[model samples]
Target: MNDSVKKRNMKVYIGKIKVMVFERGVCMTECDILIKGEKVEPVKEFVYLGSLFAYDGKHNTDIERRVNGALLAIMNSKSDSREARLAVHNGVLNPIYMYGSESWMWQKKHESGINAVAMPPLRSVWCLIKINIKTVMLESGMA
Candidate 1:
């Protein structure tokens, strides 16, 4: 322990602590984390660096949270241009969802939710292109 850490109102308690078990089966043993001779509560899930972690090693909750955030980003954008919306979707929202996607296990419902969130901006781009193509063809007498 350093004086600077104490001055910052931070205290590090060290003592015997129970090890966490990560497995497919349910944990059957009773265990507790102890610090400074005090029992520290166990947590089921925690968020770190924009990713959600669970004791059971599931990503569903985190994926849902990311999806909602992306949808909100789309909803909050003020630009009516399809290109602008696409930019925000690709630049701001997609990275959030795809950050740790390589580690995620595939679930039908989660996949559906991700696909649904991704559809709107793509649809907007399609519509914008369709309208432009129609206008160009009409102007060129090729409609």
Candidate 2:
């Protein structure tokens, strides 16, 4: 094997997420990013939101920043079809969802929450989902 080739292999891959799942003493794992790698954000926290959601943002600054923004958005709305959830990375639209995309944009009339999504071309994000009860109800039932 060439020296250069070996060095390259030793390098970490970017934009990857790593997941660890353990049950009944058996261990299962998956990942999307490598620590200290190019294109990958730092690991911030380790979280498991039941079967609904899961991610690590404890040690990752990028993850922490984004998550903080998301939480803020969720808090502000609090009671309607707010943002619900956010899928952001490096202030860009992250299309790839690691096994959880269902109901991300989910809306519940009685719910109160939103996602503080970030955008590109600078810290900007559109579409916060403003729900007008009058407008929503007008489109349904015998009016």
Candidate 3:
């Protein structure tokens, strides 16, 4: 590792080294990894590059976090025009929820999860409280 770093003229920040071990679908807490005689701390989960990574290699927590973030963005936005709010939903909220999505393994539950969170904001944008989701999606050009 040191030789590769030297060859690439790259520096490894020891303070940022972390170890997370997964075995047989379970996170191991007893494992100790050492780098340059320094003990690397083990973490159950951590956010790296704006995406949450967990020990079990599941995206549930990350999905929940993204949903919450998008919801917060919707709640904080003060646009009175439906067009402006729609733009915010398509621009800001979509990116926030869909970041790093290319690497995600598509699942039925994930689609349902996204749709469940997507409706309320669309409803708010269209000022419709009792309309069907299909109408909302069609009107918003999201279907």
Candidate 4:
């Protein structure tokens, strides 16, 4: 590893990167990898491309992170116009929730996590608008 760094004339910053090993089966073993004279600590999970991957094949961590990020995006978009805010909710938050969803064998907890993040913006949009009485009556079959 050190040799490759030296050969490429590249500098490695030890603090900025992590090294994790994903195991397939049950085995009690510890292995260390070295790069540029730095020891890499092994982790059970790692975040890559904004998604979390774990050795235990659980997506709780990933779901929590995505939900939290979506909520943060909504909270921080207070200065944007209504349409822009909706765009943030739809474009940014929805994609974050939907990304890698096909790979997930979703449980009730995962569905709840997704709903917890999705509902706030929708409720906000509904409350922010004034409903005309005629439209409301028509929708209620009174028109």
Candidate 5:
């Protein structure tokens, strides 16, 4: 509510900060929902999540980072077109792992050789759908 308080809040957005696994799901907990942004990051991890997780390291390695990227994409959504859908899909799925700790990102970018914006890419004819997910922290005032 004061000048110093606002400056502190903006600091959270001005840097590349890493959130632990526990803090992965809260986007609206620590700051106001001002200009949420998403962008893909390079993968670089080997944390085993097991088979049930279907996690492709080369692709889904940065699970946490991608999720943040996807969230940014959601904030940038404009309409329900093909590119829009891809952006949305990329945004939502960017952070999530399909198998367990593995995400479809690697598969599409590597083995499948498809860009995140190409339609009918891997999941078939079904276009991407945007889901308005409500966070637990959002209800409060801290994410």
Candidate 6:
């Protein structure tokens, strides 16, 4: 390979390298990782392609991160119309929270967490106050 091409490839590889160890429910401490004589820093958890991965093989941190991201997106939405807000929830928020959900180990607490994140913005979209969850779900067509 050409010298310039080799240099560029090296720079790209070095800049993007990270080390993570997944122990199948065990949390491991950081350890040094070396590639081509360069030390790569180990991480307990890291975000990759907008999803969080941890050493303990749990989805709780990723779920929380996704919920927070969705909440932030909904709160920042500029639409005033209920239809538009609902559209944002369907189009933007759902994808944000549900990304990579198929691979997650399903659990009741995760469901509850997702619902807790989902309902408040929906209530605001429907101009609801002190209404019960069943009513909210029905009005939102989510029941």
TM-score of each model, paired residue for residue: 0.45, 0.17, 0.57, 0.44, 0.20, 0.55
Per-residue accuracy of model 5 over 1-143 as CA lDDT, tens digit each: 24564777754442453322112232323323222353222222333443222212232344344444434444444444555545455544432433252333333344222223222221321333642223311321112
**lDDT tens digits, residues 1-143, model 4?**
67887899998887776665545576524767777667777677766556767765554546556656536655446565666665666666667777777755556778666666566555454343555545533432323
> Where does model 2 exceed 4 Å of error?
1-92, 96-99, 103-105, 108-115, 119-143
| Tens digits of per-residue lDDT for model 6, 1-143 | 23564677755365577787766655586687666667877778777556666777664445556656536665545566778888777777767667777756566777777777778788778776676887776766565
Superpose all Cα atoms of candidate 1 onto the true structure and report the RMSD in Å to 1 decimal: 10.2
Error of 1 at 62 (Å): 4.4
Residue-by-residue lDDT tens digits, candidate 3, 58-136 = 6443655665663666544665566878887787776766677775655677777777777778777777678798877
Sort order, TM-score high to low = 3, 6, 1, 4, 5, 2
Please identify which of the two predictions, 3 or 5, would achieve the higher lDDT against the true structure.
3
Best by lDDT: 3
Please identify model 5 stretches exceeding 4 Å from their true place: 1-62, 80-96, 99-143
Could you give me the TM-score of model 4 versus the true structure?
0.44
Candidate 1 achieves a global lDDT of 0.55
Where does candidate 3 stray beyond 4 Å?
1-10, 21-24, 27-42, 47-53, 58-79, 100-106, 130-143
TM-score, prediction 5? 0.20
RMSD to the true structure for each prediction, in A, is 10.2, 13.2, 4.9, 9.5, 18.1, 6.7
Location of the lowest summed lDDT over 10 successive residues in candidate 3: 58-67
Q: State each model's CA lDDT, in order.
A: 0.55, 0.32, 0.69, 0.61, 0.35, 0.68
RMSD (Cα, Å) of model 6: 6.7
Report the number of clashing residue pairs per model: 0, 25, 0, 0, 16, 0
lDDT of 6: 0.68
Which candidate ranks first by TM-score, i.e. highest? Answer: 3
Q: How displaced is residue 54 in candidate 6, in Å?
A: 2.5
Q: TM-score for candidate 2, please give it.
A: 0.17
> Which has the higher lDDT value, candidate number 3 or candidate number 6?
3
Q: Itemize residue pairs with steric clashes in candidate 1.
A: none
